[model samples]
Target: MTVNFNARPLTKALIFRIQKQNMHYSNSKYWDFCAPVAGILLTLSFAPFDYSWLALAAMAFLFAAWRGCSAKRAALRGYLFGLGAFGSGVSWVYISMHDFGGAGALESSLLTAVFAAFWALFPALAGYLSVKMKGPGQVILTPVIWMLVEYLRGYWVLNGFPWLQLAYSQLETPLAGYIPVLGAYGAGFIAALTASIAVEICRGKKRLLLITALTILWGTGALLRNQTWTHEIGQPIRVSMIQGNIAQDQKWRPENKINTLLKYKRMTEEHWDSNVIIWPETAIPAYLDQVQDAFLAPLANDAKLHNTDLIISVPVQETAPVKNFNAVITLGKEQGMYRKTHLLPFGEYLPLQPLSGFVLDLINIRLGNFTPGTATQPLLKAGGYPFITLICYEDVFGDLSVRGLPDAAFLVNVTNDGWFGDSIEPHQHMQMARMRAIETGRFLLRSTNTGMTGIVSSKGEIVGQAPLFQETALTGTINPMGGMTPYARWGDRPVIGLMVVLLLGLLGYGKVNVGRISVTAV
Candidate 1:
């Protein structure tokens, strides 16, 4: 009798059962939706308040269901977890759209849900594959599979967002040392492994000593990177960052332009001793060339007179008909500019223009039809030192923000978080910024429009931090240096490659073992 394994009805029946089970738990029409939502809510415990580690706990529960449950059910659970995590994590996007974008509540909420659902697929696929994949332990290749999926989601989607990864929550932990080596992706792997190992131990697996010893490997991370990434190769440069705390509604208005400039000038003047005075993303409401040359001339003159570099955020117009963004423009240090490359969808420019505007306007900011900048390359040096520059939201992506480092003396992140307003968004924003410093072997100088602006060292230590919603001038001197970390030079390739190899090994082992079982039965 000829048998077709591909036609096996067992898998189909299992998947149907899983779909039904998931549908019963979730209110959504989609199957397995509950898992993603549960995962997201579970991750909240991992945030700053009290139960952040609970994020890992939540991940563990999902991992089991993925490894042992029906593949279809596992996939559904993964997507559900993603929905919950991103639904809450990126809720800030809705604020930007509804309150600022002019998109009404209902429309913005629906779009946010759609956005969350799209990203949730990353986890859903990872979960589904974990079942198809066999590993040494239950989901032993979990970290590899997770990272592969995250990398795909972050890159495959429109400009992709790698926000709210489990690694971001552990910015302060000793395991963070792995960030520079493997980038944030490596941290995710380690964090996931720890959680999975814990789950196995909890399930009465007698591998305590082995797992305990393996976790101890993180000690190497703490020891090697206990100190700062780079030493002061150059004298400290003084910088004054102005936080205007402007309301998002009035920010793009023509009438608020003068008030915005005056507010920043006031805060900036307070730190005349500063050698470098900076502003946040699009600090100037007008385009780069549109603002009176007189406006830029003085800042340039002041930069030269003070022998300092004054960087301001403004949109720049290009002959290409694209309005490029510097977000922060350096004055005095003429030619001092680091243009933003990665653009924000809907917020910066509409993705699909034909019907995109209608969809974007629903979110409501005018989006200015801004053009994307040409190069996200590096800092525009002045006063004899190289500084890396990353605009708002740019720092959240570990790869983009930390690139061109090691060559540069320090890093600069300019952001406008006023759109979020008094939400956990700012705190989390600051938290993610700190992780970038840890990832790159350099100091970071943040000049934000609203607050949480300050200096963070290579060790991810917050040397100086500004309070949220306060209009203030933060002046500090950050030591600039040139040093390299394993992460700075190699990027995520090594960690990801390790993961891929591991997954292959698991698959091979499973295939061989299953063959042996079949043979023995015959």
Candidate 2:
């Protein structure tokens, strides 16, 4: 068949323009497909990459994808974005599950996908509810809902994997200034709100108003960044953080136990001149009761003789319930103990007792059957300095980490990141520790097995750091500081209160706006 263009000139031009416009519209429809890339951008905005501004751009893309989309479509878009975000960011989970847990390659990949997919539901819910609930004021309401989901992600899960929270990316950004006053959740809310404004700017909506709001938000952060929220209460104390660099595969073997104990002992003996020395979590591979007579008692005597204090992590047993605790204890100065309260599901304890055997067989690590500790534990002390003691991943909980508050002078986090091997988990873990310092206005002395042993200042700066995967000790002088940051005194109550008020106000305004539009239409 031969096609002929015999139309008049004006009519042909109109048809061509219509076709061009339709083609442009067709091309624009694929923006929603960009959600995966948006997720990558979001992931890179955090720890290892440190390109923080990409977070805003990523969220802007998400907002555009979700705009005018149905709830189901929005959920799909959000899920894809999450797969990209958590799939890449928390990819270290696979290392822990496979490299350390003895899972086969296929099993590890599937497990990681499931974990990421489970958490993806939070953002999916956020997207669905944002469209469902935001009757008129979608921009502001969307981010508020997003923050609500972020809060739930840290609260309602099996304990919580509160990693890669939006505020964490801003630890070096001016937005971190809001942490002392509002806490990380509050800062995250602001970060998400800023991203929402960026989306509006992209859509060419309320440019002047959004610009002014952003200026005030960032300017306030800039002003607050230099303000000191906590003060030094005593002289600087010399501290040593010992990194044993024990491989995960070798740590728990019966034959390697004695040698591991001797290695830590030798390192401790060398560091006794320091005022305080810390050993990483489960650095003793055995229960405190088992090691007390053979190991700890002798170490205690040596520490006292040298006028030094030692804090060590061990498993502690309780007789009545036959439960075990992932605990830290001190010797020679302030004798106190801190048991880990926030436990990791499956890794620390099985979700249900019936499936424990099967779960262990599949995961293949010697998972701990730990009982959660009470929150009213005493503040641990070392070398006359009261300390907020955190074990392993517990420092990820900002509110829990600061519970000891103004009473505790500084913070100490002891971890064993050998489980994740030479992966990004250690780097991200260190980043979270720095944020904890910023939130509480206290220096953090972190000791880890196989990396990130360092001292972080109250301002979230890593003042001293040891090389990763090394068997070395990091020594530094840390001042015992007093006075509560606004976050420590009030906790996250103010931020939660503000969120409640804002959500209610937005819902009311949306109702009023819908009513007015309805009346105008009639």
Candidate 3:
């Protein structure tokens, strides 16, 4: 199916060509795209939907199989391939919007299609750009394109959704060390690069050195995961993470706050033996100043007297009247607080007040307008440990925790997922957290308001966790760890910078040797 670039609008031949291309792709005209199209569709099943590494590897092979006819052809195939990948990857969004998001099947499907289309564009752009930038002599430009597109995915539209990002491949993988340095996006960039490298190697391309180089890099990460990144400087400490599976609707109700606090107190009372005890997002709903002054006064005094440290979450007001989020403090000996910088779109804050009623009506829920917190200094000290803190969905954002509090100790992430309720969304959330722990090399202690609480060491190992939708205290000892992962220190700058260099490097190489490559049937 060929597209005529010179066609005028409303021309019969132009309309016929459009119809021809559509029919070619969907029916039988464009058999050339069938393999790549199938390969792309196959990738959707490889995601969390099935969790198969073999499937991922196969997609890589298939993508390489049907690639490199011409620059325009490559881009078109890539676009078609991505349509298949994202169309299936985010099919669950339909469940979220229909089952949980309160939309009918058709409405949800349309919304999901729009979302998938946006995601597919990134990969399409990557494919097109790779060919455009690919060097003539032994080039692996697919990875370069992938990294750039992934970087684009991280921005655009309320900060791009890195969901289904390539980093998740390392969630349960041994390539954990790369995460701490490159961040998930960084790791993803490497993964895409490696896949393209593998493709080039398969094509009998020169050197085959990049494949070996990538292997050695990740092999080093595997060996290094067992090594402790940070030395212990503080005395031993313990923490009790309480998971209250309270429904989101009932969590902040005036009457329910009492039960919520009581539930945490009861579940955690026995664990007071631990040096530090933490609760999930808004485990206590009242603000700092609004707290029964008498209650907190005694609570703080007792924690100090008992030689304990307490870090808890509660919505606190910012200025005299404005309310920014404050998962405020009751730290023992020295008290400090962390305000969540990034707030959830609908859950914590409502945007465009004129449409507030319309949005709430769409979801069948009340929406709050929570303000963003100042770049509050790191408040990581607790029972002698210093760490960085992020509340709720904040853990999903890349570099925010590391950049916001670089040079801190480990990571402390508090979240409440009762709202998602028995959905795969929570598991998706957990997968992202695990990648973060790996990328930063800092011990990640995640305490969820409802469940999926755990400890992730610098090596990305999950040493402890509580199951979802339960009320209980998960007590565990964790290292107050710190270390500079490549990503932690440089983020994706290295990946992007290198890609730019490669683009320039390839121009000369392509000019010198691409004729030979074309002759060889690439």
Candidate 4:
């Protein structure tokens, strides 16, 4: 007898076995260990590593681990993931605190752990809510909750950290095309949505539909990348960004103050023939009043003679109720001043005062208590055109950058990232600064202390860059871009508002579905 053996049943049986194994693995206690690994994977997706695609896999792993689990288990898994992500991603905090902030190794480690733990709660909250709001459409609801928590962590909690956002990882990818139209958070939502769809497909739920949606989303982004959101209106101008390479420990010492000032002044002198000369944050190393007549006045005069604009950052001290502001002043052709409106918490000004003060005292860490500048200050003039000035940490806030819209010809950011030292912080900071350029549709001139000083094109590409830990001037030509991208015009309102509406609609639909199920049972 001829046996008609079919391969279809064997293939199906093998597929069933693999699916069973996957399901078992996801449900097992060992899956909780994957949470932190997923977090690390997400970190690798960001700058330095630039493994952008791993971001999707990391999110998928976390989502799969959260599925079919109890609220308590999900919270534990979420916290673990957060701990892993923040721990690995921002361990630079220890470098800043111990190496520069005068905190002991033990104290710095404890404080860093505390900082990471605090941010991790946001993710834990997201996981808890996802489980509580569990419904037939969990794939949709989970991602929404995740993005909401991300917004809270980045924008609301403790004056906003906004580091290592998923959108930053997608900068080189086609998804980056969404950045100009939708802003960083909006692009992040799309990334989260894609991750959710991927999880559903892995679970064998509407694979064709999910696959189609994925294709459309990325394909649209690829097409969008070719579109020019902003146009260049004026002639190209030569710009020089001075990277002082000042050591963090020695920067504020009274002994090094004059040397620092002279070094930057000398650097500026060399680039005076350029249309614009920029300095790193606190490059003056002294209050403006202290250096006004002796140093800056002559420098301003020289810049005017050369027909070049000098933009410098120095702390401005005001008496009568004593306050200091992180101020940027321009000299030559046009005179303007921009005080930093957004300040870095803990670094610039401590929050939750008494408690924060006590903790810092315990760790032996001292920080500045500078006053914030007014919100509606006029755009500063540089290279004969109005431009937005962001001092150090202010550039991290996207909405803050949008305030000086189509009126500003370009963007300038001055930073002192030496505090983080020979670490990933500077590179990560450069990544965020590039995003600001893309969002505004303007060339971003970023000058920094201790490297990564560069010129970012309107498309977010680094056109000119200085070596890390090197004292050098990065020279480049940038056209004054006019007009605004969609992100610059609307900011985050449209994207955030849509997310809120979608979440509420899903909740309402879930409630209705439950009601129908109850009626059928009765």
TM-score of each: 0.88, 0.92, 0.80, 0.94
- By lDDT, the better pick of 2 and 3 is 2
Residues 1-522 of candidate 3: C-alpha lDDT, one tens digit per residue: 433342233344654676576544333325335544553544443334545354346446534633534455555665566666667555666665565555677776776787677566665666566655654532355665666676777654454566666777566555555676556665666666566666667767654576678678678767755655455545556877777778765776798877777777677667778888887887777877776474566777877877888878887776878666746565677787777777775456655566755855775645456777677565567767667788877787766767643566678888876665666557767777877776667777888877788887666668888987777788888766555665677876676788778766777676544333222222
| Tens-digit lDDT string for candidate 2 (126-159) | 8887767755567788888888888888866777
Model 1, which residues run further than 4 Å from truth? 1-38, 45-50, 135-137, 225-229, 320-322, 352-355, 361-365, 376-378, 517-522
- Count of backbone clashes for each model? 21, 0, 8, 0
Residue 203 accuracy (lDDT) in model 1: 64
Clashing pairs in 4: none
Candidate 2 global Cα RMSD: 7.9
lDDT scores for all predictions?
0.73, 0.84, 0.66, 0.88
Model 4, poorest ten-residue lDDT window?
Answer: 513-522
Best candidate according to TM-score: 4
Off by over 4 Å in 2: 1-29, 352-366, 516-522
Best by lDDT: 4
For model 3, the local distance difference test gives 0.66
Per residue, candidate 4 scores C-alpha lDDT tens digits across 231-302 of: 988889999999889898999999998888889888888887799999989888889999999998998999
